[model samples]
Target: MKISSKYLCVILLCIGNTSVFGQSTFGRLKQKATGIAEKVIDKKTDELLEDKSGKKDNTRENPTEKVKKERVKKQNTVYDFQSGSTVLLKEDFLPDVTGQFPMQWYTRSKGEVVEFNDVPGKWLQLYSGTFLSPTVLLKENYTIEFDVIIDFPPNGNYPLPALKIGLYDRGNKGYILSNDYRVKNNVNIILSPYRNELRVKLKSIENNSNKIATENYILPDFTAKLGKPVHIAMDIQKERIRVWIDQEKIFDLPQTVPVSNLLNQLRLELESSNYKNSELGYYISNLCFADGSPDTRSKLLTEGKLESNSILFATNSAKIESDNQGVIKEVAAALKQDNAIRIKVIGHTDSDGTPKQNMALSQKRAESVKRELIEKYGIGENRIETLGKGDTEPVEKNMDPNEKAKNRRVEFVRL
Candidate 1:
C-alpha cells in the first residue's frame, strides 16, 4: 500500500520521540551504578567523644598524700586556686598580635607581633610568659587545650618550626619532647635540646618522697609547619594523658606526670637545627586551663574536632546521631520570623552492594526521611530536597566487614 507524505512525517516524529525516551531511560540506568563511592567523610562520624578515667596509680601518688596524709601543702596547691572550672578570663587580653607586655617580673609577647620575617597568611608570633614562678598550676590530674602556630625564619636561632611542649622544675635541664640531635649526624643536635626549652628540672628538685621528678612528659610526636597554625591540646589526668594537635590525636599516653603549679609555663618552642642563623618563632595565643574554656577539650570535641575531621574513626556499630526535635522546632520558628532555609536530605549505603541497588535504596530512604520531616516534623518540601549518594561516599572506610556496616547511614543539611 502507498503511504501519504503527511502520514509518513507523523510516523517519523513518533520515532524521534521514542528514541529520546530510550536515551533518558538509559542515562538513569547508568547513574544506578554499582559499588561506587558516595560518602566523602570516609569514616565513622556517628561516634561521640568518650571520656575514660581511672584512679591514679600508687606509683604516682604524691608522697605527702601517701606518707603524710594529714598534712596538705597550702601554698602551691591549685585545689584552692580561683582559676578552676568557671574562672573568667581577662578582657582585652592579648590586645594586639603586634604588641608586648612586661609586668614587674614577667613579660607577654602575644596576639599578633610580626618579625621582619612574615609571609601573608602566615601567622605572626604570639607569646605570653612570666620569667619565673614560685609554684605549679595544672598538676597530677588535669587537661590543657590551646591553639598554636609554628613559625620559622630564614636566619635566626631555631631553624625548624615545630610544636614543642616541655615541663620541668626549678632548673632548665630535661628532655624537651625528644630533641634528637643525633639524627642525620647533624652537629646542631646539641642545640636541639634547647629548642624545646624547659625552665623546670625534675631531677634537680627532690620529690617529697616519691622518686618521680617534677618534669612531666607530654608527646614525643608533635610536629608543626612554618607559616601554619595548629589548634593543640594536652591533657593529664588519672595517670593518663592525651595530646591533640590541630584537633588530631598525634600522641596518646596514659602515664605522664602532672604540672603541680598554676605558675607552670606552657610554651610552643620553635625547632632549632645546626643549619645556620634562623629566627624561630611560634604563635601561641589563647592559653587556657579551665575545665571548659572556649579553647579547651570540650570546645575541641564539639566544634573544632568535627570541622577538622581529623579524628580516627572507631571500629564499632553504626551509632544513631541524636537529632533534637526541640531544636528543629525552634529552627522552624526562626524561619517563620525570617523566611525559610533550604535544606537537603541525603541517603547513603555501604560498599558491599551494587550501585543500582544502592542508589535505589538511597533514593527511597531519602524520600522516606523527607516525607517524615515535612509532614510530621513541619519542614517544608520546597525548602528541602533529597539526594541518594549510593555507596560512593562514606564517612569511614569499609575496608573490612565492620567498617562496611558503619558506612550505611543518612545525613541532613540546612543551607
Candidate 2:
C-alpha cells in the first residue's frame, strides 16, 4: 500500500487547496511533501518550494542572498541621506486590516492593505491612475521617506507606470480627493523605470500656474532593482528640493520649489498605463514625513541636548539602518568641531515588548550608536558614554504607530 512521490505531491496539493486537513496533519504532510520533492522535483521547482517554505539549501549559495548581502554592505558604507527628526506623519499600514482601504489615507482610486508572500509587514497596494494622500498637513521644511516595491512577473513584458510623489497646496481644504488632482503650487518628482534604465524627473509649479523648474536624469541598470524594496527619500528645504533613491542622489536643485508656495498636502500617484492591475503591482510602506532639517550643531552645542528621531534601527533589533547614518555623521562633525566636547548617547524605545526586553534592547541600541560613531566616524570611544531609558521616558504616548515612532528616538546630551 505504498504511494508514489508523484501521488503524494498531488495529494499534498489537493489538501493545500481545501480546509478539510487539520493544522497538524497539514504541517506533517507539507514536510513530507517537501522532503519527497527534493528528490523527485526539478531544481527550479525545488527552489520555488524552498522560497515558499522559508527554507534554504545550505549546500549551494543562493544568488538572491548574495545580492541582498552585497546591497546591505553597499548601503552601510554609503551614508549621505539625513532623515528629519520631528515626526509629522508615519504610516506603516499596521493598523489597517488586509483587503481594506487604509483608515488614515484618502484615495481617489481603489487601493488596499495587502501582505506579500515574501515581504514582511503590510503594504498599501495602489492601482493604476490612483492618487493616494495621507491625512496630514506637511510643513514648509520637511523630509519624506518611504519604501516602494514594484513587482512584475519575471517572464512578462510590460510597461512600468511612473510613480509620482509631490507636495501640493490644497487651498486649506480638508482631506479632499479631487477628481482633477492638480494644484497650482506643487513640486512633483516622478520615477519612471523602463526596460534597462530609470528616468527621474522633477518639476515644480508656482502660484502663477507656471512650471518654474524642470529637470530630468537617467540612471542605467534599473533592472537590478526591480521586484525589490527600494528606499526613496525626499528633502524639501524652502526653495531647494533634493531626492535620493537608495544611496544615489538623483535630484538636487537649489531652487526647484517656490518659497512662497503653501504646500500642505502630500500626494502619491500611480500614473495611468496600459498594463492591467494584475500584471504590474505597486506597493508602498513605511512612509514617514518629518518636519524641518535637524540643526545638530545648534541643538547639541547651544542647547546642550538633542533628541533625534532620524537614526532608525531594524525592528526588534539594534542593527542601525544605513540610510539614517547622516544624523550620526552630523553629530560626529559637531564633536570634531569641538575636541573638548564629550557627550552621552541615550537610547529610547516604544512600548512594544516587555520592560526587561525593552531595557536590554535600548542598551544594545545605545552601544550600537557608540560603535558606529567610533568605528565609522573615527570618534574616540572614551569620549562617548551610553545609556538606555527603555519605554519609561517616552516623548509621546505609545497609542499609535506614529506616537510609537516619536518615542523611539536617540538623544545626544552634551556632557
Candidate 3:
C-alpha cells in the first residue's frame, strides 16, 4: 500500500503524543510521592529529636495557658480558684472609648481607658482617691476576678502605690461619697504590691464587729514581675472570703465579713501618694463576676436557659473576643451531647440607640453567635435559631445610665 505523507505524519504524531503524555503523568506521580515521603521523613525526624531532647510540643496551645502551666509546675503544688459557674457581670472595657471614662462604670475622680506599652489591651487607669464602681446588684455568693498592673517601681525607695478594692452599700445617705478607706460597713481589701503586704478589713456598720486580717508574703520574683499584669481572684461567700493573687492564696478568712451589710457595689479606690506622678499609676482589666453557686447543667438543661455576660463582643460589632471562647465551647459541647436538642440564641442591647438600629445590632449579634457555634464549635446550623430583643425585654429597668448595662447580654434557650 502506498501511504501518503499526511497519513504517515498523523501516525507519527499519535505515537509521539502518547509517549509524551505517559512521561508527563509518571513525572507528576513521582514528584507527588517524593513530596509525601519527605514529609513523613521530616515528621519522623521531629519525633526523634523531640524524644531525645525530652521537650514537649506546645506550639498549638494558647500562650497564656502554656505560661500558666509552666508556672504551676514550678510551684510543685496546685493552686486553683475555680471561676463562678454562671457569669453575671463581665467588663473587658472593649466598648469603652480610649482616653475617656468607661461607660459601664461610675467614677467620682477622673479615670480613663488608657493603653500601656507593656500590656496588650485597654485598661482603666484609676487616679488617686478615685472610686470607680460598676452598676450591678451584688449577690452574697459571688466571685470577682480581674487583672491589675501597678506602675510603681518594684524596688524603688519612693513611696509605693496603694490600691483599695472594696464592697459598699448605698444607704439613705445617698451613695456616701467620702474617703473609701474610712467608709464604715465597707469590706476593704488593701493591696501594697511593692512591699508584698496586704491588709483586709471586713468593717461592720456598727463598728464593733470589725475584723482585720494582715498577710505578708515573699513575692515570687517580685522585682522581675513588676508593672506586669497580675491576676486577682476573690471569692465572697456570706461571711467567708478568700483572695488569690496569681497562683497563690494570699487571704482566707471565715466569718470576717458581715453577712447583713447588704453591700451592693464593688469599688476601686486608689489612695493619694507622693509618687502619684506619671510613673505612679494603676490599671485594671478583664473584670468578671459570676454566681458563687452555679450548676451549669441545671442552668442549661433544666432551667432551659443559659445566661452569660462574659461573651464579650467588639465595639458596636458582632466579632466575639478571643479571650471568651471557652464560654462558647462549653455551650457547643452541651448541644453536641444531645443531638435531638435545639437552641435559640437571643441577643439583647441596652437603651443607647434608637429601637430600629438597636434591633438590627441585636440581630447581627445573634447571628454571630450562631456562626460561632456552627463553625468553631462543630454544631449543626439547622439546630439553632437566633433572635434579638434590642433593649425591649430588659432584665433591669434603665434607671441610671450605668444600670442599662445589665440589659445587654446573651441568652441561650433550649427548644
Candidate 4:
C-alpha cells in the first residue's frame, strides 16, 4: 500500500489524480509515463535546435544589410574634382561683422553674417526667396567652392529649403542687387533635399528662351548629411560644366552652356519655402572663386616651377582635401611622362599663426604631398624632395583674405 516518493511524484505529474489510475498496473503506468515524458522533452529539444540553426540561414538569405554598411563606410573617400589655381575672390566672411550684410556680396532679400555655436567660422545665413551673389566677374574657365550647412531640428518633419547656384549674364549691369533682374543666359544647378530623398537638377537657358539642356539626378544618403557642413565645388571650362557635392560628382555635362552666351555673374538663390526661418535654415561660407585652370605640365616642365592653390589643405592641417587631389594627379602624370625629372615639393602658409607653428605645419603639408605622389601615383619616393617655407616667402602681401589664400599654396619646382 506504501509507495516510493519518486514514483508517487511521477504518478502525480503524469495523471494528476491517483484514483483514476487504480485499474492500471503500476508497472504499465510507469512505462507509459516515462515514454510521454521522453517524447515531450524530444519535441522541445528539436525546437531549440532549429532556432539556433535558423539564424545562420537568415543571415545568408539577407546579405543586403552587410553590403549597405560597407557602402556607407566608403562614400566620402572617392574624390576627383580640382579647384583652379588663380584666386579671383575668396570670402570667408571674416572681415564682415556679425549681424550685418557682407559688404563684398550683393543680396536682394535678407541675409547676414552670423556665427554658430557648433560650427566654426562665420556663415552667411540666407533667408527664403533670396538672391545672393558675390561681386566677382565670372570667366569661362574657372572654379567655385563653398561650404553649406542645412539647419533643421532633429525631431522636425519639415522639408529642407531648395538651393540654386548658377552663372548668369547680366550684360553691362555690374553687381546689381535686385530680385527682378533679367538674365540673358544662365546655367542653374538646383538642389532639393527632401525628408527621405535628394534631387539635383541642372538647367541651362540662352537669350531668355526655352531651356537648352536639363538634367536631373537622385542622390542616396543625402538626408543623413543634414546639420553638417557640406562642401560644394564646380568647374566650368568653356561649355563644359561639372559639379560636385561633398566628394560625389553629381553632374558632368560636356556642353551645358551656350558658346555664344557670356556668363558674367555667379549667383546663389534660395527658393521660397513654407516653413519659418527658424524651422529651416540655410547657411553658407568659405566662398572661393578661382580663375584660369593651371597648365600643370607646361608650368612644371617649361617654366621649371609650378605653384598651385588648387591643392588645398585643411585649416592649419597637413591633410589634403580629397577633392583637391586632382592637382596632385596631374603632377604625377607629368612626372610619369618624363622619367628623368626630379622635383621638390614646397609648402607655404598664411601669416595667421606664429612663425614656428607655421613652419612646422608647412613642412608636414609638403611631406604629405610628397607621400601622396609616391604612394598614390606610383612615383618614386627618392625623386621627390620636400620643403616648407612657412609664411616667409609669400606670393603677395597678406593684407586681405584673398591675398592670404594666394599665399597658402603648394609649389613644385623642377630639380
Please, what are the lDDT tens digits per residue for candidate 2 over residues 1-415?
A: 2347686766767576657877787777777767766665565566664644577655467889888899787855554666777898898999999999998777658899999787888998988654556556666678889999877654556667888877787733333355654466878888887777778888888875666556568878877777789999987766767788887877766567766646776677887777778888888999998886744554687788988787889999999985353678778978998999999999999999999999999999999999999998889998999999999999898999999999999999999
Highest TM-score against the true fold, candidate: 4
lDDT of 4 at 203: 89
After TM-score superposition, the amount by which residue 297's alpha carbon in candidate 2 deviates from its true location, in angstroms, is: 12
**Whole-model Cα lDDT per candidate?**
0.41, 0.79, 0.72, 0.78
Q: Give me the runs in candidate 4 sitting further than 4 Å from their true place.
A: 1-77, 153-159, 171-180, 210-213, 294-415
* Tens-digit per-residue lDDT, 53-92, candidate 3: 6775657468999898997677544364668888888888
Tell me how candidate 1 scores on lDDT: 0.41
Q: After superposing candidate 3 on the true structure, give the runs of residues whose Cα lies further than 4 Å from its correct spot.
A: 1-76, 171-174, 180-184, 195-209, 215-220, 294-415
What TM-score does each of the candidates earn? 0.31, 0.52, 0.49, 0.53
Which 10-residue window of candidate 2 scores lowest in summed lDDT? Answer: 171-180
Error in Å for residue 185 of model 3: 2.4
lDDT of 4 by residue, 141-257 (tens): 888899988766555566566798777776333343454666668888888876555688998877766465565688777668777899999877777777888778887676677
lDDT of 2 at 59: 43
User: Which model, 1 or 2, shows the larger lDDT?
Assistant: 2
List clashing residue pairs in candidate 2.
Answer: none
